[model samples]
Target chain A: MIDLSDLSKSFGGTPALTSTRLKIAPGELVCLLGPSGCGKSTLLRLISGLIPPDTGRILLDGQDMTQTPANRRPTAMVFQSHALWPHMTVARNVGFGLRVRGLPRSEIAAKTEAALEMVGLRGFDRRLPSELSGGQAQRVALARCLVVAPKVLLMDEPFSALDAHLRKSLREELKALQRRLGLTTIFVTHDQEEAMELADRIVVMKKGAIEQEDTPSGLYACPATLSVAQFIGQMNVTLATARDGCVAWGGRRIEMPVSGDLTLACRPEDLLPDPQGVPAEVIRITDLGPLLRVALMTPQGEALTWLTPRAAAPLPGARIRLWPRALHVFRGETLLETIQPQRLTLEEDA
Target chain B: MRRFPLGGLTLLTAMVLAMLGPVVTVVLWAFAVKWRYPQILPTEWGLKFWAEVLSRQTITGPVLTSLALASVATTAAALICWPAAFAFARLRFPGRQLLLFSFIAAQAVPKFALFLSIAVIFLQLGLVGTFPGVALVQGLSAMLVMIWIPTAAFRAIPPALEEAAFDLGASRLRVFLAVTLPQAMPALAASYVLAFVAVLFEVDSGLLIGAPKVTTMPLTLMTLSAQVVVQDAAVLCVMIWLPCFVLLLLTRRFMTSRGIAEGLGA
Candidate 1:
């Protein structure tokens, strides 16, 4: 239950963040995903009151906290570096916020114990920060935030510091913890897979602007723009000229709404090897664990990737036919429409 | 308990002894009343200078004055430096590098030249021959070290730690006190002690402004050594650092980091 309105920020005279309006529902985990310098972290900092936004308002439960300092805010943040006070013991680290608030020692200790238990770090209270592993440190940071019972939790790439295996386990634990507590959380990360795995809604950001905000599958199935589709998955994007309510590509014509010259893209799974379809030349086949990916060049020299089963993978340089089950068409980065399987027609190879 | 490198250990022992040779000489030379040129050790030792240094001697008042001034300078400079050091190391602002460079640039000025100008200024301000005036100048000279050490110490702490403290509802002051300062305690302690000793070593500024009324240890050591009063100078030197050795031991725990910041892939 956080709402940001008309937020825009500039760093050293260059626009670093721009937001129009965003509403995160109670207990909803929203992920801010983008490349580096995309203003995802800037947005988080603005919300956390670490930095005041140049223009905008942050509403927590309908109270404007835009001008409030971080200490006055009801939100807490878990840093990517874990940020556990190295000199402090785990219990002391978790209790730091409470201590700052002037809470009683007994109460702080009790809450810290409960929080650590929730993160499965029950016996680590007496250990210093330097004594724990990367994952443990992160859990301590989580417990520290959770102990405060923040209205909203902010995490900036909190799992990026760990090994892949540790990251996966920690991410699952974090997600589970958030779900159990029903915490309204804003997590920032550049990892698409992490966003998909953790977020109830993913806010795809580009150049300080929100590109698309949708559920993971919703975004993957129907991206609002070319950038969203390109960012989310392995895709086969090709530029096509739309003419007279028909699509022209690779010396082939297909029935479709003629908007304008546009770019077309689809997931690798969208392209299916089929009989009774235009033939294409397979350039290479990669043996991915779950699916074998076949790379093919259309007659017009556009390369497309098709994911076939490992058992059904075609050889490299093989002449094959591919038909699309669904494909997205975009006009200058904006999504024009997604042409479903029923609307597509395969043309013969030149 | 572990396997010892015998040859390496012998070399290390010789190096340590060689390093302590001058210090031993200073101690022995302070007590020696009769010693010739080729003697390896003092043949006859006397306690005349030691008694004089302990009992109202020219160096007595200087020693006390130096300790008091150094204490004040170190405390004041430490208080001033840590916050500035944190800002210098952490905050990004316009002309940050330039500002830090100005502080370091002050260190490049020779002590005598800087003291000459400072003494003239202090005299006009009616602060000449005053303890506060002398201590203030000592603080300015010591501040270069004060800023540099804690800046490094503060830099070693991840900003995320301070941010995390703030994100969890700790104010900026609370963040510095609770998170940054505790983590940087060792550096702060090291800087404070080094600054104190640095003040004790300063002669030009103290002599220029504090003489004829205030006599700090360095002024006495400087004049004594100039007059070839090596024994008394050596005695004064022992008095200054011997007590500090205890102080250092007491604060030694603060100098070492609390068991290495774990889980940071170290």
Candidate 2:
């Protein structure tokens, strides 16, 4: 368990993270997800005691660790760069923390070997960091942190340096490992897909402030703000006027579940081809293997994207009737609610 | 490859002779028992001057003095410069660049002029003719090498490694000894050997600050050469050159794999 209360940090008079507050439950894997310079890494450093917060308190299970130095805190960090000591062989690198703790040499060796085995690197104890591949080096870094048996783990974009295929496999392995160990983790990353795949709860940050925090599905289904919606996945947003529970768009009036002028957004997959819906010109088509994406432009010049099975995809320049299967209504920047469209049996009058 | 590159080979041979000729001549002189004009080589070779050097205090005392001075000065410089080098490499403070440049600029001014001025200061401080005075001057001359190379080596270590050590519960000093120092050891050792050799052979500071009281090997060799004592000078030259050559070879053996040049360049 961890609690960060009103934590703020600044570098050279520039605020990296503002007065931020977060609490994580025990054995929960929380992700700090954001674009670069959004203060995700700063938050992780504040928690790890690598950098002192400008003003706040950090509590681990009700113990105030705000004044504790990194070495004195019951936390470990896996850096994005791996950070294994180049001069030490893999065994020494993994056993360094135990050695620092003044553990017996035989015990240190046994624990180090077990930790390496946990990371699936059993026979790599004698290899220097330079001798291992990128992924192996990362596993050794992980083993080093795990050997210390800290109360919490802090990983700052640990897999960002790997190739895409390697990153995915490592991400899955890390998630499985964290679940098995039941380790409380604070993972910082700019990768949305990684956060979606690995986080129990994703805390989306923007401009050094928490934008939204929710489960991966909750974030995708109902984003708190327009930016959160845009960040989590592809969103098709357009403005429309709502009056008396009816919405007007693209020279056609459609019945709505909500009233008042609002910005509307829908997922591409949620926009279905309907007989009695707004007409748009298909301007481009994208092949996505199993699915095809149709980019359409309304007569009013509003752009919309629709995903359909490749076999049912309309050709470019074709006119298609588009209807929202579900609509997310927003007033300014905040999402109001999601509405399911009712099937209409009206005849086409165009 | 086809022609055996005779032209290149001839040029290389000339360069090697140019470099080794004086050294070979001095080594022969140190062992020559009887040689005169028009002799292509030493007519008779023996250890006569070696025996003379071993027996005479003029040679033996300077050798001991030189070794002691080099050890003291190099240790003192390393102790003073190491923390300064780490600060230069890691910390951001006002006037850091200016301070680092001052260390380099101190080496650029002609040593004789600088030592002359320092000697004046030493006289006022009542430090002249003292071993500490000589050691201080030698340490000052060695600072550029001591600070620059180690600073570069320290800078080359990823800061994340230190942070990781801290995250794994290593105290600052523990992290330094276990991680930072070992990684930078090769470059640091190379610089130490180089600084020791440079101080051992230093003549200007010795003449200005240590003329009568502190007689180093180079100062003695300078005296022998001025007096035209060829065999004694040659013997002293070989003695001075031997430690430097041996230490350099040892340093090279270790540094070849560690990339000390990369550390310095970094």
Q: Which lDDT tens digits does candidate 1 get at residues A260-340?
A: 788878788877766755578989888889988788888777888888888777778788877787778889988878876
In model 1, pairs of residues that clash are: A130-B262
In terms of docking quality, model 2 is acceptable
lDDT of 1 at A96: 81
Once superposed on the true structure, which residue ranges of model 2 sit more than 4 Å away at CA?
Answer: A239-251, A254-262, A281-284, A316-319, A341-350, B1-49, B226-232, B254-266
How well docked is model 2, in DockQ terms? 0.46
RMSD of each: 4.2, 4.3
lDDT of 2 by residue, A239-346 (tens): 888887677665666677767778888899988887777788999999999999889998778899899998787889999998887878888889888877664445
* Candidate 2 residue-wise lDDT at B10: 97
Off by over 4 Å in 1: A341-350, B1-18, B31-37, B43-49, B79-99, B120-130, B151-157, B222-231, B246-252, B255-266
Please give the distance, in angstroms, between residue A41's alpha carbon in candidate 2 and its true position after superposition.
1.0
